[model samples]
Target chain A: MVLQILFIAIALAGVALFSYNLKKVIRNIRIGKAANRTDQPQKRMMTMVKVALGQTKMFFRPIPAFLHLIVYAGFVIINIEVLEIMIDGIFGTHRVFGGLGALYNFLIASFEILALGVWLGCAIFLVRRNIIKLKRFSGVEMTSWPRSDANYILITEILLMTAFLLMNAADAKLQAMGAAHYTAVGSFPVSQFLMNLLPNTEGALIAIERGCWWFHIIGIFGFLNYLPYSKHFHIMFAFPNTYFSNLEPKGEFSNMQSVTNEVKAMLDTSFTPPEPDGSKFGAKDVNDLTWVNLMNAYTCTECGRCTSVCPANITGKLLSPRKIMMDTRDRLEEVGKNIDKTGNGFDDGKSLIDTYISREEIWACTSCNACTQACPINIDPLAIITELRRYAVMEESQAPASINTMLGNIENNGAPWKYSPADRLNWAKES
Target chain B: MSEQLNFEVPTMAELLAKGEEPEILFWVGCAGSYDERAQKTTRDICKILHHVGMKYAVLGTEESCTGDPAKRAGNEFLFQMQAMTNIEVLNAYNIKKIVTGCPHCFNTIKNEYPGLGGTYEVIHHTQLIQDLINDGKLKAEGGESFKGKKITYHDPCYLGRGNGVYEAPRKALEVLDAQLVEMKRCKSNGLCCGAGGAQMFKEPEKGNKDINIERIEEALETQPEVIAASCPFCMTMLRDGVKLKDQDQNVQVLDIAEITARANGL
Candidate 1:
C-alpha cells in the first residue's frame, strides 16, 4: 500500500513537471519571431479534421502514407489505454477493464495487434527515410541529408515503441499469474500465456511486472518530455500548426499589415524612425514569431510535402519550405537558450533574419500557397516566405533585381512596361 | 505608325443618360483615349454605348491611371494616393458604377481600390461590348472575310487572375466571328505581358522565358493572324513582342474594342 502511494506521488510529480515544461516551451513557440496571421477558420477546421485524421493527403503516395496511417491511428486509439494503464498499473488496482472483463480482454488483444502493425509501419518509414533519401526532405542545403540523421530518427522511434510494448508484455504476465503485489499490464495474449508459465511463480512474476510497468511509463514519459527538445517534436507541434492556418482567401496574398505603422500611431509621436531597438517585423528567432508560426517550426514532421510542390524549390532555387521550418526550430533553441541565460528580449534589439533564415533563401520563394494546401496539419509556408520578403524589402532594401526594375517602372511610367504613358493610347486608333 | 482618322464624339449628357447617374462610369483609361490602334477600340466602345443608349459617364482625365503599377511594385502609399484621387473624382460625380477598357484599371478599380473605401460594380469593356452585341443593339462587318485568318486571345494579368474577368473577352470574340486559339497558358494561367508588377516601366528581368514574348510565341504556335487582348497594357506588350520577334509581318496585336468595332461596322 505504501509502495502504491509512493508510486502515485512520483507519477504526480512527473506529470506536473511535464505540464510546466510544456507550457513554457509552448509560450516560447507562440510569441516568438513570427509574423501576424491574417487565417480562415472554417476551412482550417475542415482541413485539420480531414487531413490530420483521415490521412487524405497521404493518398498522393499510397504505400508510405498507409504505413504511417497505421501508426498514427494506433497512437490515437492506444492513448486511451495508455492513460488507464498509468492509473491502475501504478496504483496497483488492476480494475480498469475488469468490469466488462471479456470486452477489456478483447480491447487489449486488438490493441496489441494494432501496436505491432504500427511498429512494422514505423520500420518501413525508417527504411524509406534511410535508404531512399527522398528528395523532398533535401531542402536548399544543396546536398542530401546525412544517413545517420534518418537512421537515428528511425532507431529512436523503434526504441520508444519497443520499450512500450515490452513494458506491456512484462506487466500482463504478472496479471495473468494473479500476482497480488505487482503492477498488472494490459497487453494481451503473450502476457496471459507467460503468466500461466509462472502461475506458481507469482513471486517472480510480481517483481518482473513492477519492473516492466516502471520502464514502460518512465520510458514513454521521458520520450514525451524529450519531444519539444528534439526534431521530432511534430508529436506535439501538429496541434497549433493546424490552428494558425491562413485566414485570407486561398492563393491570395496577405494584405500587408504594417504593424509598425499601427504601433507608431498608437505610441509617442516622437517615436523615432529606423527603430534599431524595436521588435522585428519578421522572425529572427522562434521567440520573435507569433505562437502559430513558432508552433509550425516544432510541428514540422519533416514529411517534405511543402518542399515537394514548391516551384522555386523544383526550379533549383535555394528555398525549401521544409528547411524553413527546421531552421526556425534551430533558431528557437538558440534564442530560447539566450533568453534563459540573460533574460534579454527582442525589444533590446537583435538581428532577426540573419539569425533565423539566410538572405538568399528569402528571395527564392514565389509566394505559392501549395504548402498550406498540401499540409496534413495545415502549415502555412507561403506566409513565412512573404514575411521574410517583407523584411528584405522594407528593412534591408534587398529585393530581386526584377522586383526593383518593376518598382522603378511603376514609379516612372505608372506601369510595368517602359512605353511612355503617352504611348499608352497609341493602340486605340488603328482598328 | 501614324494614322489619318475621322472620328465623332458623343455629348456628355447623351452618354450619361444612356445608363443612369453613375450606374456605369464609362472609364476612358489612357489606352482607350491614346493608344494608336487601340483608340478605335475605345471609340468603338463609345459608339456601342451610344447605340445601346446605356446611361454612363466618361471619367475623362480623372481616370488616367488606377495606380495598379505602383501598388504591385510595393509602393502602396502612391497607389493609395492615386486611389484617393480617383475615388474622390468618382464619388463627386456619384459614380458608383464603372465600365473600363483597361484590364489593369479594371482590376485596380474593382479589386484593389476597395481596400481604400472605393467599392462599386465595375465591368470590363469587353463585357459591355458583348452585352451590346448580344442584345442586337450593335452590328459588325467583315467577319466572313477574316474567317480564314486565325486569331488568339491573350489574357491580361489584371483581367484574369489579378481580378477575375475571363469570360467576357471570349464572348466578345465569338460575337465578332473570330477564332480564339488558346495558348497553353491562357485565362488564370496566362503569362504576364512582361508588363505587370511595374514591368511596363522598366526592362524585363533576364529570364529564359520572356513572358510576353513567350505568350506571343504561343500565339504564333497557333498561327494566329492577330493576338486579341482587351487591356492596353497587354496590347502594348504583345505588340512589342511581335516587333521583337518580327512577327508583325504576319501577326498583329489588336485590342478587343478594335475587333468588336470591325464586327460592328464602326
Candidate 2:
C-alpha cells in the first residue's frame, strides 16, 4: 500500500512537470501574430493522417525510411504498454490486465515484438549517424548539440527498451517460480529467452524486476520532458504541423493585404481607404510572423532533407533551408526566454533579419518549392525566407542594388526593363 | 516570305471601336514585346493564329507588365500597381480566354489576378498549339526540316511546377517527327533555369556554377540537336549557357511555337 502511494506520487509529479513545460512552449508559440488556419478542417485532418501518421513523405529514401518506420511504429505502440505500467503502478498489482487471459498474452507478445524492432532500429540509426556519418546529419549546422541531442535520444531509447525487456523477463521468471505477488499471467515470447540467465532466487528476481521497472518508467519521464528542448519535438508536433500546412498553390505568394487594399482604393476611386495601420509591412521579428509560422519553427525535425534538395544549397550558395528553420526556432526560443525573464512587452533589441539570418542567405533562395516538397513534416521554410525578404525590401528598403533597379523599372515602365512603354512594340518588327 | 503573310493584327482599342469582341486576347508579355529573341516567338504564335484563322487581338500600347518579376523581387507596391493597371485594361476590354508565350505572365495573370478581380482563362501558347492540332485545325507538314531530330524539352519551372503543366509542351514537340529526350530532372522534379523569381533581372550570386549552366550541361548530356523550351526566360538562360559552352552553333534553342511554326512551313 505504501509502495502504491509512492508510485502514484512519482507518476503524478512526472506528468505535472511535463504538462507545465508543454504549456510554456505552447504559450511561447502563441506569442506571434494571429492567423486564420481554421478553414478546411476535413482536408487538414486528412493531410495529418497521410503525412504525419502514415509517414508518407519519409518513404522517399527506402533504407532509412524503412528503419524510421519501424522505430516510429515501436515508439507509438510501446505507449500502450506504458498505459499498463501506469495502471499497475497506481494499484500496486502485478499484471493488472492479466484477467483478460489470452488477450493479455497477445498484447504482451505484441509489445515484446515491437520492443525488439525498436531496439534494432535504434542500433542501425546509431551506426548510420556515428559510424557512417551521413553528410546531411553531419553538416555545419549539426556540429554541436544538434548532433549530440540526436545521439542522446537514440541511446536513451535503447536503454529504455532494454529495461522493458529485462523487467518482463524477470517478472516471467518470478511467476514461473511461484513467487507471491508475481502472477503467472501474460506472455513474453522474445524476453522469455532471457529468463534462463537470471538466478532462481525470489529476492534477486524481485530486485531485478523492480529495478528495470523503475528505470523504464523514469527514462520515459525524462524523454517526455526532453521533447520541448530537442528537435525530436516533431514526434508530438508533426501531426498538428502537417494539419496546418499551407494548402494554397505552392508557387503562389500570399499578397500583402495592406498593399492590396491601397491598390484597390486607388483603382476604385469611390471607395475610401483607411489610414495606415502603423504596423510594419512584413516580418522583421518573430512577433511579426503568424502563429502557424512559429509552430512550423518548433516542429522542424532538423533532418536537413529540405537543405539537401535545395538548389541554392546544392549549387553552393549561402542559403540552407534547414538553417533558416533552425534560426527561426532559435530566435523564437530566445524571444520566449526574454519575455519570461522580463514582462510580455519586453524588447530584446535583436531582430531575426540581420541578427541571425543574413541578407545574403535570404537572397540566395530560388523559390523553387523543392525545400517544402522535401520536408517530411510539411514545414515550409521558403515561406519564412520570403517573409524575411519582404521585410527587408518593403519595411527597410534595403534590397540589393540590382533588385532596386528592377523595382524602379517596374514602377516606370510597368515591366522589369528600363525600356519606355512606347518602345514596347519595337520588338515586333524583328519578328 | 514576310510579304506573303501580312495578316492585319488589330489592337484591343481598334477591335472595341469596331463593336467587335475577339475570341481571345494575346497577352504579349514584356519578354514577347521587348526581348529580341522572344519577339520571334510572339510572331510565330501570331503566324499560327493567322493560319488557324482564330480571332485574336493584342492590347498593343495599352498592355503593361504582368508584375510577375516585381512581385517575385519582393516589391509588393510596384507589383500591385502594375497588376492593377493591367487588370483595369483587361476588364475594360472585357477580355477572356487570354494566351501568352511567357509562363511568368501566365502564372501571374491566371493565379494572382483573381485576387485583384481580373479573372480569365489563360493558356500558354504550347497548350493552344496542342489544342489546335488536336482539333485538326492545324497540321505539321511531314517533310519539315529537323524531322526525327533528337530534341529534348526543358520544362519551365513556372509552367511545370508552378502551374502543373508538363504535357502540353511535350505534345507540341510530338507534332514534329522528333524524338523528345528528357533531362535527369524533368517534370515535377525539374530544376529552375536560374531565371525565375526575377533572377533573370539580376546576376546570380556567388556559387559554384550558374544554375542555367548546370541545366544546360544536363541538356547536353542528352546530345539534343534542339533544346526546346516553352518559356522565353528558360530559352534565354539555356541559350546563354549553350553559348558559354561554345555549343550554340551545334544546338538550336527554340520555343515550341517556333518549332510548330517551322513544322507548318510558316
* TM-score top scorer: 2
Candidate 2, DockQ score (0 to 1): 0.57
Model 2 per-residue lDDT tens digits across residues A272-347: 7788777777789888888888999999988898888777777778888988888888898888788778865337
Candidate 1 error regions (>4 Å)? A1-10, A30-65, A141-154, A163-213, A251-291, A345-350, A400-402, B1-79, B82-86, B89-112, B121-266
The lDDT of each candidate is: 0.63, 0.86
TM-score for chain A, candidates 1 onward in order: 0.80, 0.96
Measured by lDDT, the strongest candidate is: 2
Model 1's alpha-carbon lDDT is 0.63
Cα lDDT tens digits for candidate 1, A132-227: 766665555423442444555566556656655555565666555565643343437533444444434656555655665566566666666666
Candidate 1 versus the native: TM-score?
0.69
lDDT of model 2, residue A386: 81
